[model samples]
Target: MARASSPKRKPSRRPWRRRLILALKILGVIAALGVIALAVTVYTTRAQLPSFDQLKSSPNGQMIRVHAADGTVIVSLGPSYGEWLSYDEIPKVMRDATVSVEDRRFRSHIGIDPIGVLRSVKLMIANWGTDRRIQGASTITQQVARTIFLSNKYTLSRKAHEAILALALERKFSKDQILELYMNKVYYGGGAYGIDAASRKFFGHSAKQLSLGEAAVIAGLVKAPSHYSPTADAEAAIGRAGVVLQLMAETGAITPEQAADTDPKSVALAPEPHQNSVRYFTDWALPQLDMLIDETNAPLDVWTTLDLSMQRAADTAIKADVPKGVQGALVSIDRDGAVRAMVGGKDYVSSIYNRATTAVRQPGSSWKLFVYLAALEAGYKPDDMVVDEPVTIQGWSPRNDSGHFSGAMKIRTALAYSVNTIAAKLGQDVGFHTVADMARRFGITTPIDTTPAMVLGTSEVHLIDMTRAFASVANKGIAVTPYGITKVTANGVTIYQHEVDRSHVLVAPYVAAEMTDLLQTAVATGTGRAAQIGRPVAGKTGTTTSNKDGWFLGFSSGLTTGVWMGRDDAKRVGGLSGGHAPARAWHDYMIKAVAGRPVEQFDTQVTLPEWQLEPDEESYFGQPDNGMFVDENGYPIAPGTYPGDTPTGPPPQQGYPDAYPGGTYPPDGSRTAPPEQPPVQQPPERLDQDWMDRVLGRTPDPDRRAAPAPARTPPPNDRSRGP
Candidate 1:
């Protein structure tokens, strides 16, 4: 026993090896427990997750984005989403900025970055119980999952859910697809849900139009939208954007010189509109969706013909001039019939009704365009003499707004002054049916009766239609079909394309030119002078009975614009006339609308008739003389008959020349009050053919008839001279 104890006395020196083995065993058990926990988390999250297809397809998130022809955003319905741009369609700068700022390892990661997660964990642990906030390290894939499927709540459960879905998405889609999805769904503050919307909301343009600074600014909003929003604090947003640019430079997304050359502060933010009048355009355009595309759950991108600059100009002009409680509408069209700008009402939020496309009102003297067109077609010249005396047609005696006629005057002067009696005579000479036919041919879809009052625009017509008719005249006889939607695309695939057959001629070129000459004279020296833009303008002024509606429709610089101001309830507006408020609005809008455009001259050669060249010394020309020198027969009297009258003072510009002596330039009201007037002719009551049915591309129902419009009654006083 002594010998055995002596051998056991030698103890082992490698005690460290036993400790190492124990450590290995503990690590292996811990690893097993971690693996089990991860498996459980994935299993639970997977169970609660929706299918990949379900997550990708946003059925209720249908957005109809209406864009201007220049790719400006007019408005969007439902969620504010940009077009779903593919990876290639997205600008490289936008992609690089987003990737470099949001996730550094986006390209190398497989849905989740292990190093990033570990770093985030280390940061969280180091900052625990401190004032420093914990930062997240979500890869782009994880973000896509959260944006498309998960809630925004910050919780361990949500993190687990996002991670599981991210891994699943990686397996299901390529990296590029994942990135595209993320870019299209990521929130960029200010109600914008994508790069496109953010670009437009902040820069007044599209995603494709984004500059390097703009791209960086948008990318910086990913961290905290409310914090980095440019609209909130531009300096802070620029600082964040500068940081993003630096990140991009470090990542080699952009060169150091490029970063140095970029100025984050140079980015201009789009001015916020006082009221969203563009909603009127979207409201008018959204109904066309059902007719353009097949039923689909995918979001739609509707490219329209709107000109955002012109729309802004119109909104500004209308708001500045239109009196409160009264509404105004405007429509501008290109020569090709593309609707550039549409302002349906002064304020869209107060009233959802669209006066431009839906509300039908009397056009007043503007309707005389058709009557004169018919007369011109009947071989009547502008210089042809027409008597502007009181006329009766079947117990209805139509009188001028001046209550007294100017006797005989040239037809052009008659139209320029909007002489109701002269218009009635022209209607009688051309036959009322012929005038009605002319109106129909010029895009007047409302039912026009073959009566004398029809010559004065007694029938109700949509503002858009009258605008289109005037546009047709400006187009030099080619019929113009006002269209807003140019095309529609869903999921980057074009589902509908607008096609136009522009070969149809509505009138002879010569006739159109003659009409243009007449309209030009009206704008140059007649009632529409208020709408002059120091360029070649051709238009007419219209004022309804009791000044219920004021209208100015004109064209210049290859653009045709029409303006109307009135109350929604059809109540009278005192002193409101086409030459005053409406013409002023048109002038303000057109001056801005045509600012950058080159001046264009009309192709007209006036052929003054023999009678026009050798006028009588005492002949009248519609210029009001206050009856100082003549009776109602336009005859000259002796000198000193009226206040400060001198018979030697060139006998005055005789006849009704748009203005009355000591009276307003544009005579206030026109047309006789209808003996049995009906309420403002409402749109057809048929469910299938609602008011919008008359929009572009719709075939008006042949049998559809408006209520029989009665003849207008002249006002009692002479001061209310027709414009």
Candidate 2:
């Protein structure tokens, strides 16, 4: 039987072949379906994606204004919503209106709406070949995908891509999430990128507070923001709002009567564009930030050292105090050498020149500090005496501005008075090269001539450099690199931070302390008295030859400030002197600039032994004074090994002349002997008795007998009068 069955099967074995053919057909059908599904997904995703050029060039994000902690706007960048919220912030009316107009069955559709698609197709066929109007059948998910992931082109390919993306988006997110994204990302005209901006631009309110009618109007603008913008045309927008209201009624979001009663007022355009307050500071700091960041194409948020209060104070002071025909600059730096405020010119817009840090003008007497410092380093004391007599140095004889010589003045008085003759003498004594070297070491990058005139401030320097050097003094001799920025942040991360460069330059603390004391005295009682702030302040004032330049450099507890006033063409202004205009400006600014800050004291205890000067008795008496014991140039030896004889009288006071047991001497070296003492005519006993009576507050009667005269002889004049 098996043999017969096998023969029959062999005769008609087409059954197995038929079975194989059926299996191949099933496989082909499955493969075809898979290809179709993949094709649909690829077409949808590609259509929705925006081109690289559009995304790069288009302004689609939020515009945010960044303000300081005290509300001074420092910068403005695009699209900073600050924080994104969920759909809960969306008003109920807005949500309902959006759903009704954009997608009637958004709650029911998995991703795409068949009814909406059919209606849209009918409208497309009816309006074919007419460029007047077109209908969109995009659900909430589809619109969100188009806005977030697609370009702004209208085509069949874009539609197909949108459909596929909508399906994917629906699967990934809830309907509410899709709607929220659509509302937040969709453009609503008039430079508004989202519903929030739209609401603010049009109604001056938030989307969360929109009325039902306002919600309907805004919902209608989504399809054609420019065409339906109330700011563009009131009639067309009203018509579009009617359509949205009808859709709401049809979708049961509102009743027919509710739709009819919903009326929205026209939107009012914003008045003008907004500008930030710290525009100048932002412009000034951006370049500095670029240098500090140093990363390739990285966005950074710079945290600067600008004190807004101080900046305002400086600006106000400049505007109020700066005279006409004169350009001035002010720079305020912290003790750490961070520039907090700066005004480069009277008006930054009128002139782009930054006078604060860029202008290099002759510092006048301001450079005297360097000269004094040089003298100090050379074992010279502040009390050391230097004659203010005129002298010729390298064929240049400098004269005192006061037009008179002050004979034999202490160095401190010479510096306080800004006496050019004394400064020139000190510079010559210490060597011009030594003073120039000291200036270089103190951060003066300017070219200082080795001529003796340089000691009288012939060198040019900028206000910022002066400020930094003075800040170094305030910082206790620590050399700090001046910086404008402190840190930079981006995307909640600190991308750049300033590393302070602090180095000690002065040889000893006493050197700086002694200089500070002298400077304080200058401010308190000398030429810089105008800079006194009723507080402990140290500063120096400088006026160039013929009052061409005025400068005041000073410091407080937390700040170091420098001010300069001069004509842009280097002409004299108002005959202004450093002790007048520049010092007054410095005082006015500093008084208010550091009103509430705690007072700080300078280092005053460090005693410098080499700077101490003792009087030479041998030299004072005009004796031989031992030329062998003195230096080779016949000057008193410094740190002299031998102690000279001490004077028998009291030390000389400030106002009184030295009591040399001689009467006034002539300008020449000749002196006349004093007249013989009048026979020792002692004071009358009655005179002494009257002084005692006055001290004891007792009145003497006119009849009281006079006291007897002393036994001393009367003068020859008195004897002649009696005879």
Best by TM-score: 1
Residue 289 deviation, candidate 1, in Å? 2.0
Q: Write the per-residue lDDT of candidate 1 for residues 160-214, one digit (tens) a residue.
A: 8788888767766788888888888888886688888888888998898788999
Over all chains combined, what TM-score does candidate 2 have?
A: 0.50
lDDT of 2 at 500: 80
Model 2: how far is 625 from its true place, Å?
36
Error of 2 at 333 (Å): 1.1
Scored by lDDT, model 2 comes in at: 0.65
In candidate 2, the residue pairs with backbone N, CA or C atoms under 3 Å apart (3 or more residues apart, or in different chains) clash, namely 44-161, 48-150, 62-79, 63-79
Off by over 4 Å in 1: 1-58, 79-275, 605-723
The TM-score between candidate 1 and the true structure equals 0.52
Per-model lDDT? 0.74, 0.65
